[model samples]
Structures are given as C-alpha cells and as structure tokens.
Target: MTGPVLYGIPNCDTVKRALAWLEDRGIEHRFHDFKKGGVPADRMDYWIAALGWEALLNRQGTTWRKLDDAVKAGVTDAASARAAMTAHVSLIRRPVVEWPSGEITVGFTHDSFKQHTREALM
Candidate 1:
C-alpha cells in the first residue's frame, strides 16, 4: 500500500520534528507543503468533519495570533474556519496525516504515531 500523506508547511519546526520521527521509524509518507501547494477548501471541510474545527485549527501558532479579531470571532463555523485556514495556512495544524485506509489524524506525538503506524502496517 502507498504511504500516508503528510500535510504541513515544510519550514515549520513541528512538521520537521514529525518528519524526523517518521523517518526514524521507517514510516513511509508523502509531504505536502501548505505554503507551496495550498490546501483545498473541500479537503479542509473533510478534515473538519473528522477532527472538528478546534482540532484542525492551530490556535497556538503565530499566524493565528496575528489574525484579525473579526476573523478570529468568525472562525466558529466550518466555512469561516476554512476561510481562516486559507488566509493563513500556518493556522491549520502541522503534520496532518491521512492514511491510505482513509484515517485522518492531526499533529504528532511519538507514542501515538507509533501506535497508528503499527495499526496501519498490520
């Protein structure tokens, strides 16, 4: 089977760390750089359905912090969240992993990733 698709900004520190972790474990993945390629609104909507707006949006990032108050206030809904994510790609959480089997996960932790990889490999 093909590897998972890992979406995030290449230069993001968290994404770098996640990539390194995956490499160390010999987990195959394809990287999609949000800054260069841009995320589609439809894909964002799908993720939102699976992960919810709160999980998909990276509120801790500088891009989120710099968002206009109006935009911030409007981000409660999927449409508004998609707009925000489109306007500031960095606000979408880093290292969003979509497995070949159609499982979608956000962010990365070594332990959680290991479990997911084990399940996927099985």
Candidate 2:
C-alpha cells in the first residue's frame, strides 16, 4: 500500500488510539509489534539518523524511568542511543510511523496523524 509501516507495542494506549484513527480513516498500514518481534538494529539506526536520538527515544514513558542509571547515562550519541533502544525497545517510543517515502515520525497525536493520513492518501 501507499502508507508506511506503523511500529509499536500492541498494548500501548497511544498505539491503540493511533491504530483506531488509521482504521477509521481507511488508511492502509503494516504493523510491527515490538514485544513479539523485537526491533531490528538497522531500523533503529535509520530512525536515529532521520529523527535524531532525542526524538526517537521516549523519555516520558515508564520504560525509560525503569532504565538503570548507567544505561541512561550511556545514551549520548546515535550509536549509544541505538544500543539503549535495542536493549529496551519500550524506551524507543510508541507508534513510530515510517512512511513509504522514507520519513520517520515518532509519537502520535490525532492532528499529526490526521495530516499524515491525508498525505498518504494523496
């Protein structure tokens, strides 16, 4: 389909909401569940490059809070960020949408997703 792949944990509330939004709008998408199918290191690297480490990491989540201090301290660069995300996929944020055209977006808000859905339909 023309839409991008939507990656996140299935049980995450944000992910559930985003999925419902897409389904309601009849937007085509492929899902990648973090807990079932662990995130690929290469894909994490790509997202880090495209969206920056700060954008890709979900600091507001419970997963991040549970990280050991040493691990949290080690996240200083793209490689370090990738390592941290690989170790704790939940800290990589929920609902990372990778557009077919190669854009990587993190997080989900109804307005933001609605705009993306419109663009994908075009």
Cα lDDT tens digits, model 1, 1-122, are 47778999888888898899888878888898888889976778889899888888888878888888887888888778878888888889878988777899888888868877888878
Residue 71, model 2, lDDT: 85
Off by over 4 Å in 1: none
Lowest lDDT block of 10, candidate 2: 113-122
The Cα RMSD of model 1 versus the native structure comes to 1.4
Worst 10 residues of 1 by lDDT: 112-121
How many clashes in candidate 2?
A: 0
How much is the lDDT of residue 116 in candidate 2? 72
lDDT of 2 at 31: 92
For residues 1-122, what per-residue lDDT tens digits would candidate 2 score against the true structure?
57768999999998998888889878888999998999977788787777888888888889889888898888898888887888888888879998766677887898888777777667
lDDT winner: 1
**What local distance difference test score does each model get?**
0.85, 0.84
